[model samples]
Target chain A: MQQITTEGNQERMQRLVAVRPRLISFARLQLRDLARAEDAVQEAIEAAIEKDDTFAGRSGYETWVFGILKYKILDSLRAQRREGWWQPLDEELDEAAIDRQFQKNGRWDQEARPSDWGDPETTLHSERFWKIFDLCMTALPDTAARVFSLRELMGLSTEDICRETGLKQNNCWVILHRARLRLRACIERDWLAEEA
Target chain B: MFKMMMCKEATHLMSKRLDVPLTFQEKLSLKVHLAMCSYCTQCNQQFSLLHETGKQYEKLIERDIVTLSSGSGDSR
Candidate 1:
């Protein structure tokens, strides 16, 4: 029995290792802040160490960690909210709309391609966009921002997010909806509206 | 069923949940709303375009990752 338990712990750790990178990715997207994401992931790893035996294998190990990650993200957001690190949603939207109205003017969907058009590799692997994306992500709040990253950026489903965040379907939907709208508005104001 | 399960207030709020594409139920309500509200229709279009552009941007990011990994950014 002791040997079986030891083996199980070993398996859980291995599973945790594989999921670590993806978990960090999810947290980063959710928090829109890499340091915050890393902190959340570390918290999740600590929690997983405590409950490794409870993993029933009903879902992938990565999925389970994501569930922990979701909680970490929500906790982070709540903490930030208490610290007054949020803008009113309407204020964010109005600012985006005004920026869009001003910057877009009349030209829609006319973004220029990268300067070095022919090099697919250069475009594909450039860190330029990621750096800018990291900066703009700070504009997003904690949980709402994370939901969009998990769903939109990382390609997790509503169901997965539901499992992670411990939210019912309706609540998950609400978070996702709010996250997407805010991020879309942020991108419109910060990035897209900059062009002709 | 989705239209029935989702209310009018919820419908407008949930419209932004389409990361993949609009579902039949979502489409049904969206079509109804878009017929009356041009701004929402524009918002939806803008969302999809943003997604497409984000894909383009991801590529650029990956290249930078490679550059950093190889220490190429240090000098020629």
Candidate 2:
């Protein structure tokens, strides 16, 4: 009937509006680029429009849409995997090639300004803070890096991260421990060296 | 040796709970360990810093959600 079709189109448009920003951030997290993330999310919205009926109301609408986006991410990664161009996050983190995080003999370089790194409590949003955080996070081992990002950056719980990552609970704790240690060291060598 | 590890683990777990005060036995063992190991001292500091940082970051990220959407729940 006309009523059902009208309702469907209206609801579909609303879902699009609801899921937009989250989809942008989700894809951005996976792809690490804003444009690519926007493209993937737009593509996902188009797909979700066609399959709206398949969304059985078993879970949240955003979660269901993200499931679709996960497929897109996997597809993108698979294409890269086939091309042999996709590098693991762990292997791709090159300390030497990257702007030289630490000065020679483990001293903190003073050029970037040491006083600013003092309070993570206040300087959390500072460019240098995020830059150092990202570098140190990438320095973590692959599984640990993924776990930390999922738990911290993506705001996933241990149970959710475990399910998505296929890691055991105890393994999750170990990964978290390693991430914390590596991040602490990274901050010490690169960010906090001046004070030390 | 295994029993000692188990006892130490249990005591550490007990220490982690906010509600439970360490018994005299655990308190004594902890004092002895802290007296001997600076690594534990560093770990305690790191754990406190990390916990506080995690709580604050979660709050900040929660606030970062875009709430100015024009559409309400009924907009669909």
Candidate 3:
């Protein structure tokens, strides 16, 4: 009986090791702080191992670990919100800046028009494109980046995003919209239109 | 005179639909603009592609981070 339990513990330890980095990635995407992300991943892993037998194996180990990490990330977001770690700029100012990309008549500015991406299926498959995409995401203001991740990556609804980020509903929508426009512009100038 | 939505407002409306349901007036005005303007249509397509790229990029970054950390065995 002792040997069986020891072997089970060993197997679970190995599984946790395999999933650790991914858990950390998910956490960092939300927390945006390495130390906090590491702490969350640590707590999540320990929690998972402690409750090992309770897992019904209904999902893969990674999925289960991510489910736990999600809450941990939310806790960090809430804590940071309470601490007032974020000082979001006036959202209207941000929107006004974005509005300049279009003319007064509501047409795309000459510089801001969306250029044809030429066969998006192939562009999506290109590793280079993904690298540029990541760079653009990182370039966004921290709050905008976080909001975008919550909405696009986490698939969180706007209401939930407002709750998590402590942002008003309109603010959340404005930030998300601005992030998309800026990200699109970055990719166009730095990657696509560069060769044009 | 026909009421025309500006390109900036139309694009904002485009993104707003994702966050909340548009009012009937909002939806009608955007539809009118999109019908006349091919540029806003391209902008809408670009937004969709950006969104799709973000979804795919999330998976790639997760796997890449995992491999980088696991190879070094440095979770800290």
Best by lDDT: 3
lDDT of each: 0.53, 0.52, 0.73
Query: Residues B1-76, candidate 2, lDDT per residue (tens digit)?
Result: 3123222232243224212355787666666665654444444454344434434443433333223223344553
TM-score of chain B of each: 0.45, 0.45, 0.65
TM-score leader = 3
Q: After superposition on all CA atoms, what RMSD does each candidate show versus the true structure? A: 10.2, 9.3, 5.1
Q: TM-score for every candidate vs. truth? A: 0.46, 0.44, 0.77
Worst 10 residues of 1 chain B by lDDT: B2-11
Candidate 3, B1-76: lDDT as tens digits: 8767788888888888877899999999989998988888888877878667535644554465456446765443
Q: Put down candidate 2 lDDT per residue, A54-112, tens digits, no spaces.
A: 76455445555666776676555445446654433323343343224234533233442
Clashes of 1: 11
Query: Which residue segments of model 3 deviate by more than 4 Å?
Result: A1-23, A88-97, A118-126, A193-196, B53-76
* Model 3 C-alpha lDDT per residue in residues A39-150, reported as the tens digit of each score: 9989888888777777734545555666677777778777877898765443635566577688777678888888777677777777777667767877777888888878
- Candidate 1, residues A1-196: lDDT per residue as tens digits? 2335575466556556655665676566666667887899899987887777787555445556656766787788667556766432322233343233222432222331111122334433434544445555666655656555656655567787666555565665665555545554554454434432
Interface root mean square deviation per prediction: 10.4, 9.8, 4.0
**What's model 2's overall lDDT?**
0.52
